[model samples]
Target: MNLNKAWGILKENGFKETTKRNQILEIFEGDERYLTARDILDVMQKDYPSMSYDTVYRNLATFVSLDILEATELSGEKHFRMHCESDHHHHHFICMDCGKIKEIPLCPMDLLGAALPAYEIDNHKFEIYGKCPECK
Candidate 1:
């Protein structure tokens, strides 16, 4: 949610307290947009010259594994968003024509959770494809 909270989560996940990691959190905090490895690396490059793309990727993977972030595929690229512990879970909407991604509030599971009697569904993903408002 906030920088201090994010730092605590990373620390609990065994992430060392470093300037690079702090900067990464800052970037996410400042923008609500979901970011891919390239997006993050590009921003990091502005402030941190020694930061490598590989390192950014690795750190993002670790954050996802630790449940500190959510990874989604939008517009054919992977994106990461910080998972605020108290926030309600939701899905995404992607515009196929203009490459716009928006967070959709409804969780379809509320409607389908009872129908899944034959199989165990640990988790599910729902993405609706269409033109976004601006693209339309």
Candidate 2:
């Protein structure tokens, strides 16, 4: 993902580019899977010895508000995922047993989109729960 474009979006939303924010963005840029605040904190502490958990959490909220990132809640816990709409818009299927999240390409939208008016509907997200292959 382009960190520069994400940073520009943040700046346009009145967020300053602080060192903590930069570090958080760096982590997001490197992540290939969905990450939670706790996951980011653990990773950040290893790379940035002086970084605080609160700093990571705060920056996460800012990024979400700026629409540079997105948050998903599963079983009462939150997960953060990149919001690069240009990549692909899809939903997720999570394994409750193993805490694994799998991306599922959107198939139903094509059928529904033909029936609904654009302005009448805003956006959507779907999540399915079951044991993943390994867990099952």
Best by lDDT: 1
Instruction: Give per-residue CA lDDT, model 1, range 1-136, as digits (tens).
Output: 7778878888876778988888887887776657889989999998887789888988888778877677888767898877644577877776667545687888888988679798989878898888889889
TM-score of every prediction relative to native: 0.79, 0.68
Q: What would you estimate as the lDDT of candidate 2?
A: 0.76
Model 2 alpha-carbon drift over 4 Å, by segment: 87-89, 94-124, 129-136
The deviation in Å at residue 67 for candidate 1 is: 2.6
Candidate 1 stretches with Cα past 4 Å from truth are 84-86, 94-103, 129-136
Q: How does each model score on lDDT?
A: 0.78, 0.76
| C-alpha RMSD of each candidate structure in angstroms | 2.7, 3.9
lDDT of the structure predicted as candidate 1: 0.78
Model 2 alpha-carbon miss at residue 7, Å: 0.8
